[model samples]
Target: MRFPGKVERHAGRARDCGRHFTKTLRRAALAATCASVVALTGCDDKQQVAAAGPPPAVAVTVMTIASHGAAAQIDLSGRVEPIRTAEVRARVDGIVQKLLYTEGTDVNAGAPLFAIDDSDYRAQLEQANAMLQRALAVQTNAQSVVARFRPLVQRQAVSAQEYEAAVSAQGQAQASVADARAAVTLAKLRLERCVVRAPIAGRVGRALVTEGALVSAASATLLAQINQLSPIFATFPKSNTAILDLMDEARQGGLQLSKDIRFPVQITLANGRAYDETGEVDFADLSIDPATGAQSVRARFQNADRVLLPGQFVTGRFRIGERQDAVLVPSRAVALNAGGASVYVVGADDIAHLRQVVLGDQQQGQWEVRSGLATGERVIVDGWQKIAPEQRVRAVEQHGPGPGP
Candidate 1:
């Protein structure tokens, strides 16, 4: 017969085992359901992505590129300079007595600019004049003696040695007179220099020396500066490499500069405004500067309003030459990166293809494509950023002169 405690313990043991098994089953069922839901979500996401299909064709504005005779222009950094400049300085030693001109005003060539102490100069000039008069009196008396001796020597009335001596004395007196005359001329020049004058017509700066200030001719003391503002010069440097390339291109008959060789230039001031006057390249250095490896170029512009100033920074656009059968595209259409300059070309299949282009001069907001593009090719100028290379695009012809010529 079984004991009552033992049978109850066995039954409790069996009930605990059944409860543990039920918990295990419920946990496994919940985990399986969560896994199934995650798998279905992943399948739906992939199907949605697949159903979306290829990306929609990007809409872009394109231009059908064709050859046109466009003016070739190159922009270079430049500085505005006066066509003529002069330094007003003391030419004779004296104390500055008066400033004859109004500072910062325009003056004509040889206009009086300053007045230096003239009392000493005048005294020296008078002394020279007195000396010259004395020498002249002596020369006249010696000439009369020579005239008497010349006739006496021929007539043998006087000793020949005495007549010869008298002739020599006249020549010495004449030479002394000439020497005095030279002294007088020098004195007059020195006196004139006491009144300083403008050496050139230009706008003069402030006087460096005031009244009573001593200036030295030996040191060439600077008194003021003047610069011609009208018909000013815009000086710039052109790259030596560019010059060489241009020469080569010219030799190959691929480019033609202006017939007169005076390249037309346009100036842009520091304020980002175009100058009213156009200029021409008047001078170019014969050789490249060794330090900078650039050729110095000068352009002259009529600055009637005195807008261009000396040493002012500016930009110069040089119309160097023209190219035939050239391809051009809007500047904005080209993208520059580490790889190089490239543009989006829309193929006949309506697919945008990235094309590498060799660019020449950029004129009027348009780039001259030297290579990598041909006539009849459509280049995407607008909405190019939205598409990738070889991607289909809906090209619409751009209206108006979008960027420039």
Candidate 2:
């Protein structure tokens, strides 16, 4: 009986312990399940929040298309030159006596340049005059004899052969007088040549031959050089295609070639300063250079200030026409990508898109857009690197108006 009671008590204690272990396990499992469900829900909520947000906005400069007249121009480099240039030389062979004009001075036409030895020339003139007088006296005597012989021949008092000889003598005297007159004329020319004169009104260069230096007419040594400074010439080179285009425009009445082209010419000097005076297109070369395939065009400018010097290199611009209703943007707006030229345009949705454009000539710090952009479209001119294609951006109004006139 005592053993049976002990077994029953042990059985009861084991049953109670088994019930407690089952309850604890159930509670732990319930807590673990609830934690997993909350963690998953938090992750899903975070992902949803991230997807709803947009990409960062790009700060960029924007410009609008404007309606205005802008000129189309071709730029070229050339050299400044005098309108007229002449090398002064000695016309008569003699020792230089005096330099009549100072070096590098402005001289007028017919102004004395240099003086040669006139003493010898004067003596020759005197000799020529003396010879002329003697010839005149001899001619008078021959004429008197001829008159007497004519009458004698008619009256049969003188032989016909003698009368013929008298007539011949008179003819010889007349030939001698003509020869003397030529000699006098030659002497006068030589005297005039003794004083070298400037052929054109211009500025004179340095004197090449000094006083007491013997020079010859055939020698290469020049006395001086004169250059006409006012109304100077500028020679610039342009492509043959450009010339043809200009001609075509003239024929179409789009441009009047005969009118003064000076209004559109702008000159840039070597020092990067703009020339004050305007120039007119004076001449154009008929043929193109085979090597360069370029035609030279010459322009004339009134250089009254004498600022432009000969042989000075200068840049010039010739306005061909005015572009009407053209779209212009700042140079910075055009981006050079691997696919030629492109620009970033902000659409109405404030989203950026890369636009490929055809660019024409540049004018006044802006590029002339030929295609791919229409009026009223906003082009990003600044802050290009920060933006990308399809990226959302806030379009900010850039400072100031569009570039160029």
- Candidate topping lDDT: 1
lDDT by residue (153-225, candidate 2, tens digit) is 9899999999998889899999999999999999999899999999999999999889999988787458889
CA lDDT of 63 in candidate 1?
90
Residue-by-residue lDDT tens digits, candidate 1, 1-405: 869999999999999999999999999999999999999999999999999998788889999888887776788998988889999988899899999999989999999999999899899999999999999999999899989888888889999999888888889999999999999999999999999999999999999999999999999999999999988899999899988887788788777767776898998889899887889988999998999999999999888988888999999998887776778788889998998799999988999889998988777788888999988889999898888889999999975337762
Q: Candidate 1 at 141: error in angstroms? A: 7.4
Clashing pairs in 2: none
The true-versus-predicted C-alpha distance at residue 281 of model 2, in Å, is: 1.2
TM-score of candidate 2 versus the correct structure, residues matched by position: 0.74
